[model samples]
Target: MAANKLYIGRKVRDLRQANRATQAQFAERLGISVSYLNQIENNQRPVSAGVLVALAEKFRIDLAELSGGEGDRLVSALSETLTDTLFDGYTPSLQELKLVTQNAPGFAHALIAAHRAYRHNSEQLASINDTLGRSLAAAETTPYEEVRDFFHFVDNYIGDLDMLAEALAAEIGIGDADPGPVLSGYLERHYGVRVARATQNDDLVRAYDPEARLLTLNPYLPAPTRHFQIALQIAQLHAEAVVDSVAAGAGFRTTEAYEICRIGLHNYFAGALLLPYRRFMAAAREVRHDLDLLAARFGASLEQVCHRLSTLQRPGQKGVPIFFARIDRAGNITKRHSATRLQFARFGAACPLWNAHQAFESPGRITRQLAETPDGARYLCLSMQVSRGGRGFRQPQQHYALALGCEVSYAENFIYADDMDLTNASAYDPIGISCRICERTQCASRAVPPLKGRLVIEHNMRRTIPYSIRPAGDAPQS
Candidate 1:
């Protein structure tokens, strides 16, 4: 959103490499000098509009492919990472950060990776102060966090696997009639794997034994979940090589992380297989993103539907960019992904004022909120509680609230946005990423002071909060 000249060096370089073209060859194709092309690829020169048009014409590429989406995402992530107190006095300007993301994205990624390693080390140190050896020796990040970052950076869309799964979906006639029986039949006939639904409560939604060629699914699990699990098993058995290649290319440091990423990719593939991209996107548009209707039609759960919606970042067929997060009752974020500019806090917990937390009290209802972040971006947020496999009283029930949101500009496309006063400023709740980095000084629920602010305490006078935060650069109050 800055006025700086766009420098898409990394993208251009990647494009050239993807086409297996050298600098001279690529320049020749673009009708530009080799030196000029080299400069553009190296970020020494900004990409001209003519070159951009030429690239589009010659390569048959979508002009949107060269847009600032990835750069903006990188800037958001780097900006969040730099918000740490560890980077005090080292925060770069927004323009400077954008330059890094546009030109030297590899370095931007490295900086983020280093910061993650530092945070992981700090957490390890806090948990095991007595065992200094174990804490200091581990320089790598948590496998789960690494995998989460992978999905986050990739915009939650795996093109190859998505296409593969979509083809499978078409082949198996998914999303038509009851998917459970269809998938079960496919597994039995194709893989020679028997699928059995367990009536008794063993607390296992899906248990697959490859050696025995059997999959035992909990009967109590919703039909949608069973169908998804069958799809997942199929993904693992059907496209192990594709998933493995993707995981390998992800550059995970540990085997644990690689295995986790493999499973995550399989799960992603399963979701894609059930709700294939093009058809699902079409359905979402047709239904105005009504989660309940979409779920019923696609034989998926509310959470699955929302999660699939978040991953609609396929090249030209992109859906309205939205952010999705799932949080437990304890306020701990179980899953968070954003295709929008709004990124959730990577710290302790999400902002309490966020409507996602409000869904717990309302259970079956969809809680709608018009929220404005500190950066002044307005979002039409929707939340609802989703139950995940805990039917028996003896079994511990796991419940999490699912949140879906997009910029208010896209509100008309969202079914839950109906009947809301989206134009009224007062209807929108002010929210922040987290307490520690939030610039807001007047939030009643402020639990901690911002890193850049000084606390103003008055023993004689009290306000909503015990102390007022005096942000940096403010003169003595008039």
Candidate 2:
């Protein structure tokens, strides 16, 4: 067996520089010679066990960072991006990507930033073309998508913020039965903010008064939304230090993306505080991952429960690795995060075959589907329809679908998977990221032809699945 290798020289160097210490001075703290420290910092030698301990003891560095947590995330994201057809034949090997991550993380990050810009611009052009009633060009990235990618690159897990929120939740005596009072108490005592429900404009859900120190929530808002708004406000005020610290280093290109990133992180902390990871995971297991039961237990709604389930990615103690997504009636993915290999499309709507889109037809009901991606991975998906803005007769409600799922291998962990025919290949519905990127040739529901493939015009025959595609290279079919 190969021995464990630790290459955290860059991180060590960063810590040393941050403290304004030279090699000799830092080496003295670690009880190492200056030459040895230089060798370690330059990656000529791996960080020794003794140096690792010294880092934690003297510098108070997080051991996890030294374990390549950030590097691993970068490698995963870069690997995913390389899978795009734009780089089809040029995808680098995993070991090569890891080398880039370890040696030049900045360069790796630069490459990702460039790709995001290209992707965003492409998506924007597509949106413009759609609005002008022209043929869809390509999908440009949204600020939401940019922030989503930022979170996705980090595996959607913010370790420091999550831990801090967990500790705060425990300190405030936040119980599962009624967490609202605990959250409200914390806001009142610490920030001098009073939480109350009041009449608001039809479009406005929450309003906060700075001078009066009042948080006014719409009474018509659902119980979950109201509680969530309170928790979100608490995060904005209390978790700003930690949230700002992370955001400062996240490499967001635009101001909008950066602001959205902060809001997303604050919301994440709120969910962590509301659910309180340890207790929620225990309840998840006890109930066999029943969404309804978990929601009731946590005094949350089903959507909140599903979102919380996806964020149970604490290192060493993780719950089911699920993906959560919210899609509007028009098929635009409003929100998404995946812990599994099934990546949502960054450009446009999800695959039409995904059960979440079908959820609109059966509002308020949970729908299940065993889905197989073009890559042959199978998932057990559970989707539910939800709505907002239905306060008055004239106010139109915006409907959406919430989906949660994981790989079929983890199917046994979810109650929704009990009745699924996991062993039957035919049971799984065929799905892909989007029509432009999907390589499926004979899909009946394919909205457009694959962007990188040849479309054969069959003037002689009629077929249920239009546009037979010959992608890149293959023998001509009769």
Best by lDDT: 1
- Model 2 lDDT-worst window of ten: 133-142
Q: Across residues 194-289, which tens digit of lDDT does each residue of candidate 1 receive?
A: 998776788777888889999998878777888888999999998899999999999998899999999999999999999999999999999999
The sequence of per-residue lDDT tens digits that candidate 2 reaches over residues 86-154 is 775464765577668877877887787678777756666757855676544334455776787788777
Model 1 residue runs over 4 Å out of place are: 1-7, 16-59, 124-140, 472-478
Model 1 poorest ten-residue lDDT run: 131-140
Cand. 2 TM to true fold: 0.77
